[model samples]
Target: MNCPCCSGKSYEECCKPFHTKTKFPQTAEELMRSRFSAFAIPNGEYLMDTTFPAKRKLHNKKDLQEWGEMNDWTKLEIIKTSGKNLVEFKAHYNDENGTTQIHHEISLFEKLNNRWYYVSGKFLD
Candidate 1:
């Protein structure tokens, strides 16, 4: 199947590796794209695992599951990036009530041991 992130690649070729931990995202933008893919597939494990350790506690599994299951993801657009540690993107999806929404976010990241972790994100729209 085509990648839900609209990366012009198949899910298996583009996002599955990251979801399975077979390959790690090499850049913040890559991580952000993979996370968007995770949301589509509703893989809460990859969502939580990629989160920064300090902020991981704020993300409850139940809440993640609820959010994951409620959204029907449609598209992902990367707006910009700052070096390799920050990214801004928009994730378009439909809610359970069939309302279209844009998750406009600017996200921060940190690299430890050459692995990037999602630190935080602020939604602007």
Candidate 2:
């Protein structure tokens, strides 16, 4: 199947390695893409695992899983990357009501022990 991150590659060739922990994302953008795929796959465990350790308290696997299960993730659009730790992207999905929605955000990532972790995100209009 095509990658949910819309990387123009199969899931196995794209985000699967990252999702499966066989390989970690090398950059913030790659992490962002994999994170989006995680949501599409509704892999709450992966989502929580990739989050910055200190920030994990602000989120939970159950909520992440429920959010993913409630939505139909469609596409991911990368807007830009600034330096090695920031990524701006849009995630398109349909809500539980079947309303199309786009989540635009500039996300901050941190590299710990050479592995990128999602730190936080600032939502945008």
Candidate 3:
């Protein structure tokens, strides 16, 4: 699929490594980019895989598929990220109605076994 970051690259070359069992993102910014790619491809498995086990919600493929089908992501942008293993970002995307929405969040991630997993997020407005 096209790179969700709109960097004119394939998802594999852009952000798949962070989602797959390949490489773990070294920074929060990289993780944020990979998450955007996940939304673009509607890869719920990848999303869940990247999510911290403590924060993972739906474990069933059917539910994941349903969630994936419910949204149409258009764009993503990170406002700022700081601290160790914790990042704050803002993502903008168009919904099914073509309405643009902004999700500002402070995300937490933990590195385990040399892999970073999304722990949780606090939505800010």
Candidate 4:
């Protein structure tokens, strides 16, 4: 299947490796893309797993999973990036009520031990 991240690559060659934990995203943008794929796949565990450890408390795995399942993830647009630790993107999806929505954010990432983790995001208009 084509990657939900719109990477123009097969899912296995694109985000599957990251989702399966066989490899980790090397940059914030890669992480962001993989996270979008995760939501499409509705893998809440992977979502929580990729979150920065320090900030994991603010998220609930079940909630993340349910949210993913509740939406139809359609596209991911990477607006910009700042070096390797930040990315601005828009995620388009349809909610449970069939309402189209776009989530725009500038996300911050942290790297430790050669792996990148999602730190946080500031929502945008």
- Which candidate wins on TM-score? 2
Native-to-model Cα distance after best TM-score fit, residue 108 in candidate 2, in Å = 0.1
Q: Show pairs that collide, candidate 3.
A: none
Runs in model 2 with CA error above 4 Å? none
Where does candidate 3 have its weakest 10-residue lDDT segment? 58-67
Per-residue lDDT of 58-117 in model 1, one digit per residue for the tens? 897667767888999999999999887879999999999999999999999998888889
Report the C-alpha lDDT of model 4 over 96-122, residue by residue, as the tens digit: 999999999999999978888899999
Tens-place lDDT digits, model 2, residues 86-110: 9999999999999999999999999
Weakest 10 consecutive residues, lDDT, candidate 4?
Answer: 111-120
- Tell me the whole-model lDDT of each prediction, alpha carbons only: 0.89, 0.96, 0.72, 0.94
For this target, which candidate reaches the highest lDDT against the unseen true structure?
2
Candidate 4 runs further than 4 Å off:
none
Worst 10 residues of 1 by lDDT: 60-69
After superposing candidate 1, which stretches have Cα over 4 Å from the reference? none
Query: Of 3 and 4, which scores higher on TM-score?
Result: 4
Question: Which should have the higher lDDT, number 3 or number 4?
Answer: 4
Candidate 3 TM-score, true structure as reference: 0.80
